[model samples]
Target: MSEPRLSSLRWRVTVRRHPSAFLLAVQLLSLVLYPLFDEMRGGRVVFGAFGVLALALAVWVVNRSPAIKWIAWLLAVPAFGFSLLSVLFASESLLVLSSALEAAVYFYAAGSLIAYMMSDHRVTSDELFAAGATFTLLAWGFAYVFVVCQAWYPGSFTGALNPGQPRSWLELLSLSFTNLSAVGLGDVIPLGSTARVLVMLEQLAGVGYLAAVVSRLIGLTLLRHERR
Candidate 1:
């Protein structure tokens, strides 16, 4: 076979065999790339592009109904497009709106993937990948919400996050996962009632998700072992 044909075959096989893993890898790569790009000029533009790419991959990975896929595109395209436009136009309102939309998209995607993963009786590597990817998406979804809150009501967070500059996506991401893990490090503190409420809700969600999903996955794994 020709090189192009071989590459095409590999792509098809990968998408068929490990779509969840591919999505997980891309999501992780995007997180790493976001922080690195922050140091450069036009970084937000690059970041927004990656966000769109990740959103597309997420839609593909979920492999939901046509209507659902269309809905994902509707939310994700404007979220990423308006984000890039906000950076260019220096519109804080647009940025906040875009962040909210992005959060909504990720939340939907994460919920869908989690449901799909948990629906299965047997545990597989793809299921494991989907589980991790869902967690990452949840973190990102909350991070975007945090960004929106911070943008809408400046000083929502009191420490480490500077009001003068946009919060670092990476730092917000860290805070999100920390909150999800219920670590509650004091370095970044939520000041406003709204912020506090949001934090509490996220913590609750994280704990609930772990208790339900992790336990289910473990149970399935044990059952598979018994059957074997």
Candidate 2:
């Protein structure tokens, strides 16, 4: 094949065979990119576009799993549409709607990955990748939930730099990661009852995920080796 055709074929094969790796890569890359772009003027538009890309990749990852692809599409279509509309029109209501839908989609994707990893006795390379991808998905989903909470109840979170001021997306995301990882190092603190409740739930989820999913994978891997 020609060079162009070869490159296209490789790209397609990678997406087909290792979609979870791509999803995980994009999510991690965003952690670095988000902070850099956020300080610049007109950064919100770029942030919105980046969100749409991540959602699209999530849909792709979900489709590769044993998930019902249509369900992911159903949630993602409106999520990204509302996301773009909010960016274009600067509508607060649309942004809230989009964030909610996006959170739902991410949760669904994470569930699908869990199901995929637990479905069979044998562990595949994709399943291994899915494990990490699922964690990031949960973190992103919870971040979106924080976004909605902040919108509904202003001053939901406080940070060291701007106490009582509305938290930025990066700050919220950092909070989510710290909470979900049980790090307890985030500067953002939940002030409202609603936010505190959500944070507690995410902390439980983080512990349960490690106890359940991680343990199961390790046990299964040991069993597979014993059988071999």
Candidate 3:
């Protein structure tokens, strides 16, 4: 009876793996899918709904997958806030808001999934590598939008983009990512007080969340090696 019960659990895990992999692929696709958005209104709607959906699915997966708890699935809070802001503002604010929130989701989601893959030795190196590659692509895409925002509409870009000062294009993209990761590098000055506060919050979330991910991975490695 015990053997059969264990087999059932194993089979369930095997079945879920494929679906989980597919979800991860689609979630990654949604990142670039935003830039291709038909129009501003449509983009905002798609971005908000898709982001919210991804986080919702993440909530489910993180709860069931004990391996990812290290990344503290609770970090999805900021990502959720970004989506809400995008839906509410749904104007010039939507681009910055949606981008930031999506970045947060991918960061946490990808990081948590990495921890999950690492802990589950059954997961293939190829699959894990593919996940990492996809994440890098997502990161670069966000970084690109941040750049183009400042480039095409220097006076028009909203949110973290400073309308007042003459910051370099690299500086602006860096700021976007810094804000996306919630990392506030003091060297690049904030255009407004609100942007400053937001930057601080982003930096906290970014560093704290990544720390959680790394800590989990290291702990698991230690345990695995110790047994060996």
Candidate 4:
């Protein structure tokens, strides 16, 4: 009844009504912020925090069974903690493990969201947002994969702005999205066999995903029209 209570109630309603929009906003913001900061110490911390928030929002937005929900929470909490610890200690092993876990979380969450959207007979704006979010998350996941590979084998990627230096996450992210979109600008080149294989796989995936999503959206639109 009070003003504060009213504000809290309104906030809760908005979240409940537009969870996908909120998740998409967080995904976009992280995509921007994660690349902007360059300081190693602070950058990792910010990245860790962003990972936690993004995964949390993703899990919340997707509709899941109780068992799947529990599993998501189980994986997400430890992934977040490990990420923070890896940053704090500056441990390469821990960071690699954290990146693996984070990648798993995002992959699972994105798959679940996509599955949900596909299963639903009626499509909404939220479904469209979820699709975009899933695509972006996939890019982020692969970027971390590139990071891990680079860590394991130095000089895995070349042609970055700082040539001959270890590539930053931001640079990798830029490369990942560019590769995922099949832009192939050639500014960033993957040198190692492993890196090249990963890039090729990502390019195939990007093309396949676009095809699938476009087909599904069109099918859904046709179905809606037929029902009228």
TM-score of 2: 0.90
What's the TM for model 3? Answer: 0.44
| After superposition, candidate 1 runs with Cα above 4 Å error | 41-45, 160-166
lDDT by candidate, in order shown:
0.79, 0.82, 0.50, 0.78
Give Cα distance to truth, residue 43, candidate 2, Å: 3.9
Under the 3 Å rule for N, CA and C atoms, how many clashes does model 1 have? 0
| Model 4 per-residue lDDT at 180 | 91
Off by over 4 Å in 2: 40-67
**lDDT for each residue of candidate 3 in 1-228, tens digit (9 for 90 to 100):** 699999999866753554345455655576456556634554544554555465546435544755444343444455456556656676546545555555555555555555555566443433444344334424433543443344444543343455365444345445655565554453454444444554555556456545754444456567777888
95, model 1: CA deviation in Å?
Answer: 1.2
Return the top candidate by lDDT: 2
Q: Residue 5, candidate 4: how far off, in angstroms?
A: 2.0
> Going through the candidates in order, what is the number of backbone clashes in each?
0, 0, 3, 0
Question: Which digits, one per residue and each the tens of the lDDT, describe model 1 over residues 76-191?
Answer: 88888888888788787887788898899889888878877778687888888888888888888898899988887777776554655645666677789899988877467777
Q: Candidate 3: global Cα-lDDT?
A: 0.50
lDDT by residue for model 4 over 1-228, one digit each (tens)?
999999999988877776767777887877667646765574854565577666766676566578787777877788777777887787888788777777777777777877877786778877877778778878887887888899888999987477898877777888999999887765778999999999999898889888887568778888898989
lDDT of 1 at 121: 83
Task: Report the lDDT tens digits of candidate 2 across residue range 143-216.
Answer: 98999999999988999996968888888888999999998997899999999999999999999999999888
